[model samples]
Target: MAQLRYQSRRFWGGLVGVALVLGGSGCQPQQTSTETSPSPTASPQPGQTDPEPPVANPELAVYWVAYKDQEQLVLEPTKLPLDNLENATSEEQLVVAFKRLLEGPANTDKTNAIPEKTQLNSLKLQEDGIRIDLSREFTTGGGTKSMQARLGQVVYTASSLNPKEAIWISIDGEPLEVLSGDGLIVSQPMTRKEFDDNFSL
Candidate 1:
């Protein structure tokens, strides 16, 4: 009976010790872990444009073309204008570019006759080709080696900037003969070898 009484006393002592530890003033509540918020995404840097290039220029972008008959610069009717042409800064750039082409060299020598004053009435960029209607001046005389090259130079210059398949040359509403003694058309790209093989001078 005395042994049983001692065992009971030890069990009660352990329970009291556990209770005291749990109720201690120094003990604190468990803390919860929180995930930190990710930093905000960054914006694209300048000059790093999207892989797909924009066909028509941006809202504020400027573009220029040549038109001699008209005193001032003008945009090609075929080109899309997000806004009014008058407001575009390219209006001035067109004048400067056209003037430069007029003075530029086509070759030299007996072929050195200056190109006639021609106006670009219309330029249609089609899936298969580009249709260009010129002024009456584009016709007339002036058929020589250098004069023809000058014609090619002008057509090549415009097509290069916009990047199109063929450039069909026309006058009034008809497809005009290329006037070159050799049958070379400006509706598409022309290589130096092709010019040599076809043209005499």
Candidate 2:
């Protein structure tokens, strides 16, 4: 009986030991740890800067001329600085004004009477007035009405700068003694009042 009891105890103890070992093995972790790094970014190279913006021009005001309702000569004042005329001498300023006049009316509602081919030959500023010489084209082709309007354009544009003074008009350096268009005798040193008497609203 004692021998049989001993064999039964041994068999139960062996079975319990095997079960513990199997349980411990099954509970063991598979991984230890994990780590990763981020990718690098590129930097801007030398002379790879952004572009700059445009510079603006300075400006000033001056006078010009345009025709109104197709009959009367109108004063069209505008900024003449952009043409580098703002700092020019008085003579140069007159030249600039005439240039703008020859360019024609900027506004769609106005029109120009001065001939396009007419060139400013010389400008002589005097104590009491200004003397102007124009190309032969100044007197070519325009009839009475056209010639009158063209003369009005010059008189108004030039006189506006010095309202108290007069302006003498000439063709190719010769005195405009007569207006061939209407046979009107032109006096030296023509004033705005004289032009206004002939044509104005």
Candidate 3:
């Protein structure tokens, strides 16, 4: 009887040892993963540059005819076209100004003394003064007052760059000695001061 009891107790102790070993292994904490996911990256953008500057417009004054208080006719100053002529020479600017004079004035209050049919033949810069040639239509019409107004317009516009400079007038390649049916004698190489002194607008 003592041998059987010792054998039974030994068998149960062996089973309990196996159960404790399995339970201890299953109760252990699980290890966390060490690997990580990649982070997102931003896209690159293009660089910016500065803007360009604005271009300038060239300007000059041209003469027109107007009356002061309706008393008498007088020479009026008008602005020329603002063209893109930054690199143009003085001669080129003068020619452009003269052409604008022939086109007449924008204001209705002012009068254009030059005939509408009159045209610019040629213009040249000389050592003595500026030479201007006009079409025959310049002297074809107008009374004494008209003739004087047209002549004043030409003289002032020609010498606009240099008021002291003289101006030689020609009509159809011929020197203008007498102007219109009024037979107004025009002296050659005219100047602004000379015109203002002798000619009445």
Per-residue lDDT of model 3, residues 8-45, tens digit only: 99999999998999888987788899867644433333
Candidate 1 wrong stretches, greater than 4 Å: 1-114, 162-164, 178-197
CA-lDDT, candidates in order: 0.48, 0.71, 0.82
Q: List model 2 lDDT by residue over 83-137, tens digit each.
A: 5654678777777777767777678765665677888888788886898899888
lDDT of 2 at 100: 68
Question: Candidate 2, after superposition: displacement of residue 150 in Å?
Answer: 1.0
Worst 10 residues of 3 by lDDT: 37-46
Q: TM-scores across all candidates? A: 0.38, 0.59, 0.68
For candidate 1, write residues 1-201 as lDDT tens digits.
Answer: 999989989899989888899877456676687856544443446876545555773232222233437443222222233344456343233333334444433433112122447666666555555566666766555556444555544454345434333556667887765565555454333433444355442
Q: Candidate 1 has which clashing residue pairs, if any?
A: 166-187, 167-187
